[model samples]
Target: MAAGSRRVRAARRRQRRLAKGTHDLTEVQWTALLSAWAGCAYCGAEDPSLQRDCVLPISRGGRYTLDNVVPACRSCNASKCNFEVTGWLRRKQLDEQDFLLRYAEIRATLVTDLDDLDDPRN
Candidate 1:
């Protein structure tokens, strides 16, 4: 099989898996993943309540793979819609400082809040 065909097949399988809504990641996993990305992969935002964002359009052909996903703020996620990261960033003229700040905060939040995870109210 061609490399392209294999990738398409894998993506299709992934899409079906997602449709079943049986995500395997635990809360800790989600925290770690989101912390790594800091914010949206498109136009960067450093909001604390960033939502999970898909890199590729699921309707077209996107997988839930870690490599193709990131946490995204509401504004950036909406503006990005179904576009690619490069297009979204170019259209918005996204700055690097925002990303840097987000990354730094992401690290700090996780480390500082490590003890809070044990709290039932959290």
Candidate 2:
């Protein structure tokens, strides 16, 4: 295979590996969840039905890592299924710039050294 082809294959393999749902939260993820104060990271809604959502959907090769996730309410999370963060915000008629800024702030508070994409519990 050509060098470029090799790289593409490797990337595909990685994406396939990361597409599965781990259903396990790392310590870092736990910290992010707690730090969100059980509220939606996107809208600041204090919802008991909150869920950890992938900012970049898994189908798009988004890794299930600390940096790629945020706490979101069930409504927002379900509505955002497989949608890119910015796109979802736009579709919801939200201010993209403001949402991105808030996302940045939320991410900053939940930064972690753990970079594993697969479930750690596995």
Candidate 3:
């Protein structure tokens, strides 16, 4: 298949998977937003229009679990569209290690399985 076609197919699969996982996270997502206690995850804008975002984008093979999601302002979430989390953080001039540390904390909060505690992919 052509590269573009392959990408499109992959995106569709990711979308389907993400949709399945995010169908009922309204309350949990809102709680996450409130817990942010500041602003956008990427830009740190206080009181920006926030939305639930995937740190590891589904297009990049990320799950739609709470641990893989975060609270981001609309602007930051839109800007990070489908990009790998680390690369998007770098583009925004955010510290990668800091972001990873924060992500680890987020994951820890929702982690029930011990194996989920140490995902190197995040």
Candidate 4:
């Protein structure tokens, strides 16, 4: 594909994601998420430059909310583009169950923290 076409496709994908839902993952939340994970969610690479990747993928109706996003290294993000998480992990010989379990635990903790922040008592 031509460079122009690729840009157009990316733009269209962005529009589609926006239409589907809000990208409400805040910077503070992102920081907490990164700290919780301590590395790439998929490969556990302790790289400083991690990208926010959608668990379900934008093309497949995923949004950038905290529940659907994780920190991924560039290589894993590129390799897993638009592919379902479990299947992609299996193909790469990674532990899908581990990722899922860890993700659930981290998400729960972060959500609880967020809720506490919203509470008047906090």
Cα lDDT, all candidates: 0.65, 0.72, 0.70, 0.94
lDDT of 3 at 25: 42
CA RMSD, predictions in order? 8.6, 10.0, 8.0, 1.6
lDDT, candidate 3, 2-121, per-residue tens = 999999998898778777655444564556544753567676777656777877776666665666667788888888998888888888898889778877775665554334545676
For model 2, name the residue pairs that clash.
none
Give me the candidate number with maximum lDDT: 4
User: Candidates 3 and 4: which is better by TM-score?
Assistant: 4
Can you write out model 2's per-residue Cα lDDT over 7-54, one digit (the tens) per residue?
899789666767565635586576655465457877778877678788
Q: List model 1 lDDT by residue over 1-122, tens digit each.
A: 69999999988976685796533434674677676775554455678888766666555566554434568889988887778666667678885456546655654665556547767889
Candidate 1: 10-residue stretch with minimal lDDT: 20-29
How do the candidates rank by lDDT, highest first? 4, 2, 3, 1
- CA deviation > 4 Å runs, candidate 4: 1-3
Clashing pairs in 3: none
lDDT of 4 by residue, 16-115 (tens): 7778787899998999999999999999999899999999998888889999999999999999999999999999999999999999999999999988
TM-score of 1: 0.53
TM-score of each: 0.53, 0.63, 0.64, 0.91
Q: Could you tell me the lDDT of residue 112 within candidate 2?
A: 38
| Predicted candidate 3, C-alpha RMSD | 8.0
